[model samples]
Target: MSSSFERYQKRRLISSYFSVVLSVFLVLFLLGLLGLFVINSKKLSDDFKEQIPMSVYFKDQANDSILKAFGEQLQKSAFVKTDTFVSKETAASKHKDIIGEDFMQFLGFNPLQNSYDIHLKADYVEGDSIKKIERKFKENRMISDIVYDKHLVDLVNNNIKKITFYILIITGFLALIAVLLINSSMRLSIYSNRFIIKTMQMVGATKSFIRKPFIMRSIKLGVIGAVLAIVAIIGVLVYIDSQLPNLGVLDDKLMIGSVLLGVLALGVLISWFSTFFATQKFLNLRTDDLY
Candidate 1:
């Protein structure tokens, strides 16, 4: 009977440890997902900003040689990511294809002017920055007009700001919840061994000596949990990439390493702190109060 009871207790302890590990894994996995989303959001925003196109039209009298030199200069500008010079003939051909008829034939002349289709760097796509770029470009004698959808630029900037604000709020709230849930799991696991803690204290063992084993156990569990969470997060990223190949979620290795390291550190810290406090609580209690 004694051996059977001992076996049951050992199994129960193992079960309790497993429960704690599983709980920690789930919480950290959630936090990891949020971190992934936050990191990817910045990249996605920049990609969108860089896709907004603008055109710099040249004066009708500007010759091909002058336009080619201007194009080379534009390419060297810090603000420009890419620029393509569209000659008058090419522009007319594109318009003709789009309209399904030769507008040049109907009008008896090609009226399209030579222009450079410019895509600005993401940082310079905002309203004020674009205005500065426009002013600088218009200073050139060969350039006639700089045209872009100013309203669209403003709208994209405004919407991205709103999205960023909401993401920050959501991230903060989710992080708080993750910490609370992990701490609670650790506390409950420690609570089950309260009597053992009290017994160790009553036997004249130093508090640090008594707490050492439990702290070490918690740390081991924390590492296991963090490793499991990281595996789960990688699986999720893989699934997302499969479904949305263009997202390129797994392309940023540095961010992924940072998030994984952060999750591991958080798990160990939370587990150590929670276990320390919970063990201390029972150690300070009177023998009768343990009931």
Candidate 2:
């Protein structure tokens, strides 16, 4: 009977430890996902912004030197992420691809004008800013006309703003949920050892002395669980990088590193507080309460 009782207690302790680890892993995973979205929001915006090109048309008098100078100027401009100067021949080829005929051959001259195709910085790709940019371009003497999709700019900006707002809200809510869950798990684990805590108090052990071991153990468990979860998060990034190379934006090292550090700090702090409180509760309880 003595042996059976000891075995049962050993199994129960092991089960409690596993339970705490699983809980911490799940919470950290959720937080990792939220961090990924928040950190890579810029990459998300740039992906769409690059697809919508802004064209700056040139005058009849514009030559290779003029176009080259303009390209060099744009390269230094904060508004420009990338720019390409398209000559008349290249424009004609693009037209051929679209119209399914060499219109230049039929008309005896290329009607398309030379132009600069520019992609704006992600932050500058908005409706009002794009219009202001067009006006800014028109101030130059060499530029004849500028064209871009006003509606698309509006759509992209609006969608990005909405996504940012929702992600923030969800992150806060989930973080709260994670804390509450870890607290409950810690409470339950401590509750199982309530009699031990009470018996130690009955002896010569002071409150602080008894509290030390439980808190230390909890801290260790928390750290182990957090480290495991961080490994899982890194594994997730590696898997995505290999399987969906198109989503490379998800691999921002600084952001992932920040999230990992945050998880470690949160896990240790939460475990410390939960263990302290749980031990405190049992310490003050009456002897009959142990039953």
Candidate 3:
């Protein structure tokens, strides 16, 4: 009867420890996912910024030769990524599609002017650089005007900055909370085994000797938990990709691997430090406090 009771108690303790470890891992994994989003959002914002259009309207008298020369010059500009020429005919065709065939027919001759659709590099989308580019475009004899939605560009940049700031603040707060929670859970787990620690200390065990096994155990637990969390995260990513095909494009396999490795390293590091501190605290506690 006594042996059976001891076995049951041991099993319960092991179960509790495992549960706490699992909880710590889940919390860390969630934090990792949040970190991933914060990193990738900036990338997505930059990608969109690179695609913003900058339209250069040509003079009515500008012939294809002059327009082509202007395009070549524009291509050589530091800000330009690529420039595409949209002739009057192409412009008319687009307008006809938009306003219907009869509406275009009423305007006997094509009234649309030729233009160059320019895509700038992401870094040059700022107000100062765009203004500089505009000035350069106006210097060209064949170019009449440069048109772009400045308001939309400003709005996008402002929103991205605001979002980045908020995400950084939130990430910092969440990380602090996660660390505290994990530390508390680890302390409790160690506290449950305080008597065993005390017994070893009483038998002439040095502090390092007492700390070694606990550290090793914590590391093992952390590794197991991290692996489980990574598996779960991968499953979640796979499901999301299935539901939203576009999400698959955002899936950087190398980045995902790095995140997984980082999570594992974090788990091991946090667990080791938490266990060491918790064990040290108990080691310094008075015998009377044990009860």
Estimated TM-score for each candidate: 0.94, 0.92, 0.92
Question: CA lDDT, every prediction?
Answer: 0.89, 0.87, 0.83
**How much is 179 displaced in model 1, in angstroms?**
1.7
**Cα RMSD (Å) between model 2 and the true structure?**
2.0
Candidate whose lDDT is highest = 1
**Candidate 2 weakest lDDT stretch, 10 residues:** 247-256
lDDT of 3 by residue, 115-177 (tens): 999999888898888898898778888788889989978998889889989988988898787
Candidate 1's TM-score:
0.94
The Cα error of candidate 3 at residue 37, in Å, is: 0.6
Which residue pairs show backbone clashes in model 2?
none
By TM-score, highest first, what's the ranking? 1, 3, 2
TM-score of 3: 0.92
User: Lowest summed lDDT over 10 consecutive residues: which window, candidate 3?
Assistant: 244-253
Candidate 1 accuracy as lDDT: 0.89
1 or 2: which has the higher lDDT?
Answer: 1
Per-residue lDDT of 40 in model 3: 70
The clash count for each model shown is: 0, 0, 0
- Write candidate 2's Cα lDDT for 23-89 as tens digits: 8889988887678767767686787887799999999898889888888889889989889888888
